[model samples]
Target: MRNTVLDMTRLATMDAEHANRLLHQVRAAILAGRRPPVAPRPVIDASWQRMLRLGFDPDGRTSSELLQPDELEHRRRATVIGEVMRTLSGGLTEIADASLQIMVVTDPQGRVLWREGNAGVMRRANGICLEEGAAWTEDTTGTNAIGTALAARRPVQVHSAEHFVHTLHNWTCAAAPVHDPRDGRLLGIVDVSGPASSFHPATLALVNSVARLAEAELRERHRRTVERLRSVAAPILCRLTGRALAVDPHGWTAAVTGMAPVDRLPLPKTFGAGRVWLPSLGMCTVEPLPGGWLVSPEESGPPEAANRVVLDLSRPRRWTVAVSGAAGSWTQELSPRHAELLYVLAKYPQGRSAAELAADVFGDPTRTVTVRAEMSRVRRYLAGVLAHRPYRFSEEVRVEVLRPSHPSDLLPHSSAPAVVGERQMPGQDVSAERRRS
Candidate 1:
């Protein structure tokens, strides 16, 4: 299926009113349970199905509860996105103004954080409840570029009548999700919105590019922060008495002494200056550094409290592996490659050899060397709950897999032989709570 439903290329060449009318007919047919004249793009179709299941009223009012004024200001000040607001505005605001559109930036939860651009369109946006603090998630506002891009975790363009909400049919939007480059956490969305006449297929590309630029800025900022932390850690580690390392809040290692350096330390979420047990390090004393933590490992037997491991592959963009035991619990967000490997291990708790894992993950048994290297890295942090003889979780560890609410969302970006097969599984929702992904 094409990435866009309405083919803005064709629509750009057609009369605006006529193109809108044609898509209106298609949407009307879809809502009436008849086949659309042209099937909506796959993303739109999935979103419409989700809306139908949600029992949304296409004709209902498009308002969302606006965040209180103070709350709005609080969110604006609390995120790094605020630091780069000038970059976002400077990059898109002029173009949006020239094109009769408004630029919008939303938090990860889809609440409007900041918006600027064409003055007239900004007023029109207010009429549709697109003002600061209004929610624009899929469930709240129907199929829209901002909401759909959040769900899809990718750039999207929603043209006139392609919107599931009838009131939004006169408007058009393009959006792309911005993620924190340091850890790949979604920061929010950047969008361009205006009247249907302002629709341009290229808007999605532009929004996507600007979103990337925003991430690049964040990455550079994080690099500088880590460098400063390294400077602070250098002299401190020199006086350390045992195997110690300095790591940023997110676990990125700044420096290490008396041990081989690893890229990260996998600290717990609630890590602070105190004695703590880690999955990788048996027991350690942590102290506060200038912008990070100083960790000193104790020479002792590792705790065996990791009785449960939950591999979560439910979200489209983020995946986590959480471990719990008497010692406490820590959650490590998995990289994409690690997520795929863990999913396969969770599915086959009995075990998988290096060759078998290679086949499952890369569809090539000869890739065992690569598989072994990855497993070596995975074991570095998960040594407490993982066994390497056959590359499986420790027999004592109970494992659970949290699949997506929708099968297609299971490792949505993975192409591994194992994950792809799971994606084709019909009606799969493996969450232990039967909750949404």
Candidate 2:
């Protein structure tokens, strides 16, 4: 619950003889196709089960394949994670070197993008194929820190013999997932790894702290970018009136006139000059602006509540929610972010505040601004049904969610904290319903 790798730390502190005996018992149980011994923590037992399902052979050798230099360089250039790497590396370098450990950064898919520190350990790492460009996913490498942390969406430490592969039994690793501050998408992982003897309980805390710092840096960078956009929008908004606003590409409002400020609007991926239907504003004139979009509201009647809302998340890439009322039935395809927000809202019909929704979607309670902007868009479509002041669907309307036969397929592209947590819940046919008042 602390989100640190306290389990492995506890293992590290055990007397050598007791630790070895426990390890032996776990290994024997796993080899015999039995549940892990009680000595192994629940997280470790879960990892072992996942590895077994993935067809990993505990006795087999781990792969040492590295990506070609050109491919590695290309991936590094394309990732946003590179922007915060300098900050992460600076904080980790001294500690990594002092402990004879190596600091590794991996993309969400568990491909190692960078490695640094502990020259002697670096060379030794190569023998196990723990180098830049090598894939260390749980499916590929079996129960290592980097992959398991990504799988668990939290910090974890995997110590010697806890590793599924025999070849990695001599190593230890602590890793925490890093996320994009703007949307809670997993960007990569920051890991500290070395010979098992060099394992330290404090490393999990250190890694988690640095990962948080990296996310904060990303948030600051995004804020600065939005501020620059606001400067561009300022002069433009002065000439506009009558409930008009200027919004950046991601829908963050840069400026508003003759209207209360809204966090953001839902603009299509390829928005251009046109008349578009906006949720709260009805049909609106959309025009391209220097840094974003300028939208002016058009007249429309209040939304009718003789409606049923159906959330369809069964398809692969396409997610949609349909609204049916006396006016007619209409369905809107959702982007990954929108899909995640709606899913969380539907799950808790009791309603959620901006901060609560922020914590659910972004894993940070202070991101209410972001949550408010997104919810503004959601309200546009479900105007009469969605009520604010602690957002919730109107009790008079029935809500239903259609999910995939396999829960894992729900919102396949989302890595938002709440989405990840839902995917892991045990169920096949998942659905949530709220009845009319």
Per-residue lDDT of model 2, residues 68-149, tens digit only: 9998998899898999999999989778988999999998789999999999999999988898999998878988999888
Off by over 4 Å in 2: 1-6, 30-36, 64-66, 266-281, 302-427, 430-437
- Encode model 1's per-residue lDDT on 1-437: one tens digit a residue: 22336666887888888888878888888899997767676667767866886799999878999999999999999987888899899999999999999999999899999999999999999999999999999889999988888877778899888899999988999999888877667789999999988888888889889889999999899889999999999998898777999999888899999988998777665779889889888678899988989989887765555788888877766788898888778888887789989888877777899999999999999998899998887887787778877877887787888877878667754668898787767786557521111
Candidate 1 off by > 4 Å:
1-18, 302-305, 312-319, 334-341, 350-381, 384-396, 403-437
Q: Which pairs in model 2 have colliding backbones? A: 279-380, 280-380
Q: Using TM-score as the measure, which candidate wins?
A: 1
User: Model 2, residue 414: displacement in angstroms?
Assistant: 14
Task: Tell me the lDDT of model 2 at 84.
Answer: 91
Top of the candidates by lDDT: 1
Candidates' C-alpha lDDT: 0.85, 0.79
